[model samples]
Target: MHFNETELPGVGKKITFKNSEGIYTVMILHHNGKREFYYLEDDDDDEPLFSTTLTSEETKELAIKLLGSREDEPDDDSYDHMSLVRKKALVNWVEIKDHSCMIERSVGEAQQMAEEEVSIVAIFREDDLLSKPSDDVMIADGDTLMVLGRKKAVEQFENICKES
Candidate 1:
């Protein structure tokens, strides 16, 4: 199974999962603690075959079940997609501290990520996740940024953020 994630701005994040059997599942996590689920027959289909919504608590329960308990014997079939993602790109969680160069600058001015081949995937602040942050979004002290890129580029970005 492969899952692709995208930011929906004012809405939330959208995650799509596809399996080799041509099955597709989409989950939209709203900022307001709601989740919408959709299913598609195949990639060519624009409309979902079925759709439903889940409350935040229900979603959490489902996630726990899917992840299983630590005691549960590891199954060979239970693969971790995060490891695959890490293999292809370096992901970092950087905190914007006092006096850091990133503190008050917008993403565009603070870090020209495209030129560096690095991408700021999300900003985590006060338990809220902002995915696909716009260039105008300003960084603030105490903000946690999630960035992705090749190792060297990611390190460069981190260095830029850490500068006083």
Candidate 2:
């Protein structure tokens, strides 16, 4: 997995190196938007602490290499149509905020929205982890909704929420 800029601190000081057999002499340094691996023990006195050439890809590769290769790197046959759907604009999306509506009529609105050829995939309560919310879900204050089916349906649903 690519570590985002936030996850890794792109900074370092000094440098040094020794390439010994059976042991890789390297550490990843990320600075600015660039990243790479480096030899921690090997540094010429002439070079500055901030000077080193390491790419994020190389660092990731060396790290993974230390952990051994994964046999499941190329496996993903679980969900049919998932690959294709992934290639297209994702149907799954979240509403920005929980807008109040008649709890009883919410489902009906969702249904009518669905009839317009859009589907109401799901509505999630706020504070949920966003992994997966269940069916028969209810909306409440601070709820985050997960909707799917079609773009048009989602837009219409939002519009109705705005109106109500």
Candidate 3:
């Protein structure tokens, strides 16, 4: 794959490339150590189909996972992208709505309500990220949960959250 880099003058640098699937990808490395990513249908597209911003630390973590560091190796329960597809395993984010049944419940209580094999990996509460949060942590409305499990189990967990 060929990569093209351009300077953004007062901003930083812009890198563009096409992945194996021929989807155009762009990365903007800001001077302040922030990274912005975008995907386009074509190189000349003026607007991105999707975009996201990542801090320096988050970018480094994503790089490590992509490059497969020894410490980041998958365990028995975890699978690579291809393996995950074959096993129907999934990692999903579920947001707690105001009317959801999970609201006001503790993390452990929500887990018990699902009664599935899903694992709540982390909870994103506004600006804070609670990684491997304790079971006693309250599940407030508007909290985003990162869960991992088989497709069916995860779906069941999502259904539990939607129940009132």
Candidate 4:
């Protein structure tokens, strides 16, 4: 698989992933939390064969379904597809312990402190979930960080969270 990403000025971003069969799946992430998906038969084609839009919530649900959690594992035949997806990206949860260095730090501050690039997609605090929290959001002890990034970056982030 091959992928390309382009910034869309004030709009958001455009990402296109080419599968083994040469078909392209394009995803446009809008700044307003809307997502547009398109399928292209040829790389040079300007018009998509199919297109659809999804809200942020719907996007999250679709991602969850694609990832298949431990409690809702897909059938064995879907393992290969799942494996491919896992190899390309990773979504993980890192719990902030009492000794964590991230405690009390704002999300923006913590992101700059780390050498690796991993996105803090959401923060789970007991009964509440702060999705796509602002930069000023503070990290608290026992809060679980929902992070997304490459495998190596995510691993490095987990290690950073363990440091006092």
Could you say which candidate leads in TM-score? Answer: 3
Candidate 4 local lDDT, 1-164, one digit each (tens): 66799976434578999888878999987543457899999878877898988865676668778787545633544533432344455566678999999999999888777687778889999889999999999999999998776656776888899999
Backbone clash count, each prediction separately: 0, 15, 0, 0
Candidate 4 CA-lDDT value = 0.77
Worst 10 residues of 3 by lDDT: 74-83
Count of backbone collisions in candidate 1 = 0
Q: How accurate is candidate 2 locally (lDDT)?
A: 0.41
Candidate 4: which stretches are off by over 4 Å? 1-87
On residues 39-120, what C-alpha lDDT tens digit does candidate 3 reach at each position?
9999988778999988656776787788878485444343233224555546666889999999989888888776668778
- CA lDDT, every model vs. true structure: 0.72, 0.41, 0.78, 0.77
Q: Which stretches of candidate 2 lie over 4 Å from their true place?
A: 1-89, 92-99, 102-109, 129-136
lDDT of model 2 at residue 105? 45
Local error of candidate 4 at residue 94 (angstroms): 0.2
**Lowest-sum lDDT 10-residue window in model 2:** 1-10
Q: For model 3, what is the error of residue 14's alpha carbon versus the real structure, in angstroms, after optimal superposition?
A: 17
As a TM-score, model 1 comes out at: 0.46
Write one digit per residue (lDDT tens) for candidate 2, span 49-87.
Answer: 343453434544654677798544322342223323433
**C-alpha displacement of 12 in model 3, angstroms?**
28
Q: Against the correct fold, how does model 4 do in TM-score? A: 0.48
Residue 20 of model 4 has an lDDT of 83
lDDT of 1 by residue, 10-39 (tens): 445789998677779888775534588888
1 or 4, greater by lDDT: 4
